[model samples]
Target: MYPASYYYRRRLPGRSRGKGLIICLIVFLMFSTGIGLLKLINIQQAIPKFPLLILGQKGENALNLMCSAMPLLPVSIELNDESNNQSSIQLADILVLRLSRVFRLDRQSPIALLEKELPVPVEVESSAVPVMKAAPVLPNPPSPEPEEPRQAQVPTLSEECLMAVYNTHTGETYALTDGMDRLQGKKGGVVQAAAALEEELEKKLGIRVARSDAINDDVYQYSYAKSKAVLEKLLAENSQIVAAFDVHRDAGKSREESIVNIDGEILAPILIIVGSDARAEFPGWQNNYQFAKKLASEINKQYPGLCLGVMVKDGRYNQFLHPRALLLEIGSVSNSTEEAVQSARLLGKVLGPLIREIYENKQSE
Candidate 1:
C-alpha cells in the first residue's frame, strides 16, 4: 500500500469532482424545467376566450349566454339598487353588466360607456295602438259606348205597287219544249219572263209590283186595246202604280240581233220603245219619251249593250196612259225563253233604282 496520507488525498479529489458534476447537472435540469413551465404558461395565455352566444326572450326580459366549446356557467349580475326594493331590472341594463364582466371591459369601452351616458327611462301611460285604415276603392270606369247599327245602303221604296207589268202578246213562247209562237190558251214564255222580272222587283228590290195575268191574245189584232184594258184595270186597283210595261217579243230572223253577251252570261237584247201619238189626245208623249231614254241609259250603264237603244215610233202603243209607260220587247222568236228571262232579271235590277227615284220625286212634288 502507498503511504496513508497520499491515499486519503486521492479519494478526496475524486469525491469533490463527483459532487461538483452532480451539482452542475441538477442546476441545469432546474433551469430547463423552469423555461418549459414558462413556455407552457405563455401558450395558455395566447389562446382567446370563448365567444358568448346570447339568447333573449321578449317581455320576460331574460338573457342566456351559450358557449359552443364549453359548458355554459350561470352568471348573475345585480343591475337594480338593492336598497330601492326593486325585484326586476331592465334587460338593457343587465346586458351591459354581463358584457362588462365577460369581456373584462372597463368603463372606457363603447358599450359600457354608452350605458353610463344614457339617460334614465320615464314611465308613460299606454293607450291602444291605432289601426291602419284601408284606402277607399274607386268605382269602375264607364264602359265604352256600344256602336250604333248601320243603315242599309239600298233605297227603301213604298210597299204598294209602284209599277205594273203586262204582256201584250200572250202567244209568244220559247225554244225550251214550246215552239216560238204558241197562240191562244198557252202560258207563253214572255209571261214567264215578265213573272221573273216581277219577282226581282218585289222580292229582291223591295218594290211593290202589279203583274197582269190576262191573255190579251184572244184579240191579237186588237192586242193593244186588250192590253190597255188590262193595264187600266191594274192602275185602277193600284193608284200607286207610277209606271207600266207592255212586254212583247220581237220578230227577229237571226240570233245576232237578239242575243247579247253580258259578263259571259248569254241574254236576249232588250228594246225600249217610246210612242209619240202627237195627236191631241196623248199630250204626255214627250214625258214618256224622256222617261224611257233615262231608263235605257241606266240599264246600259250596268250592262254594256244590254239595251239596244230606245225606239221612237209614231204609234201610241198605249203609252199615253202613264208618263212612265213604255213598250219593252225582249229577245226575238229565235231567242230561247231562258235567255229572255235572264235579260228580264238584269232589267229589273236597273229599273229598281230608277223607279225609286221617280217615286221619291213624286213624293217631293
Candidate 2:
C-alpha cells in the first residue's frame, strides 16, 4: 500500500541504524574492559599466580633458565605418564609474563614445591664406553742357509789309514726295531757319508779310507752303542784307526729342511747334539765335551756356521769305548731326502780330516 521508492528509502535507513547500534555497542565494551584492567593494577602487590606448564623434549632441560632466576620457586622436572608415550615436563614461574622487570613469589619447601611443580618424576640412566688400542706385531726370524755340494771322489780304505771300517752294536745291533745283523738299507747311505768324510780327511791329513757295511744282527740300540762297536773293531783290526763316528738323523721337522736352497742345493741346517749323561756323572765330559767342541769348532771353521750348537744330553753317547769313537745324526725323516744326502756329503768332508789326524796322533803314541 506504500509507494515503491518510499519503501526502498525506509529499508535503507533501517539498515544504517542497525549498523550504528552494533558499532556503538562494540566500542562501549572495549572501553569498559580497558578501565577495569587499569583499576585492577596494584604495582607493589602484583604477583603472577598462573602455573607455568612447560613441556620439554626427552633428555632436554628447558627450565634451566627459570631455575637459575627463581631459586626459591622450588621447581621440578618429571616425565608425563598421561601421554600415549611418556613425555618430560619442566616447571618454571608461569605468572612471570604478568610482571614487568621484577617480581617475588611465595617461598615454598624445596621437596614439596618440586613435587607439586611437575606432574611426575623423570628417571634417566647414562652409560659411557672405553677406547681400545691395537695389538703389536712380532718380528720375523732370519732364513737358514742351503747345502753345499762336493764333486770329489772318495778315498779307498787302503789308500787312507784304514782299509775298511765295520760297525756293531753291543746292547742292540740295529739302529731301529726289527734290526738286522748286517747293514741293509743303511749300507749305501753309510758308505756315502764315510766317503764324503774320507774325502775331507784325505785332503787335510793325506790319508786314504773307506766305510764298510754296518752289522744289523742284534737287538736294536741307539747309534751311540753302534759307535762303540765300530771303535772296538777298529782297535782289534787296524789298531791305528782313530776318530770313529756313528751317523744318524733327527726326528723333528724344521724350516731349513723345506726352504734352504744353496746354489740350487737344498739342505737342513745341522744340529750338533752332545750327550750330557757323562757331564752329569763325571762333571768333566772331558772326552765328550772335547769331542763336541772339536766337531762344532771344526764344522764352524770349515762351513762358517754349518753347526747349530753343541747340545749336551744325559746319555753317554758310547764315547767311553774309545776317545776316537763318535756318534753323528745327519737329519730326521722329516727332512727332505736331498737334505739328508747333502748332510752326509758334508759330514764326510769334515770327518775325513779329523780321522786322519787321530790316526797320526795314535801312530805317534
Clashing pairs in 1: none
**Which residue runs does candidate 1 get wrong by more than 4 Å?**
1-156, 278-280
Model 2 per-residue lDDT tens digits across residues 157-184: 3343552343333222112222332344
lDDT of each: 0.71, 0.47
lDDT for model 2 comes to 0.47
Highest lDDT: which candidate?
Answer: 1
Error of 1 at 61 (Å): 80
Residue 41 lDDT (model 2): 28
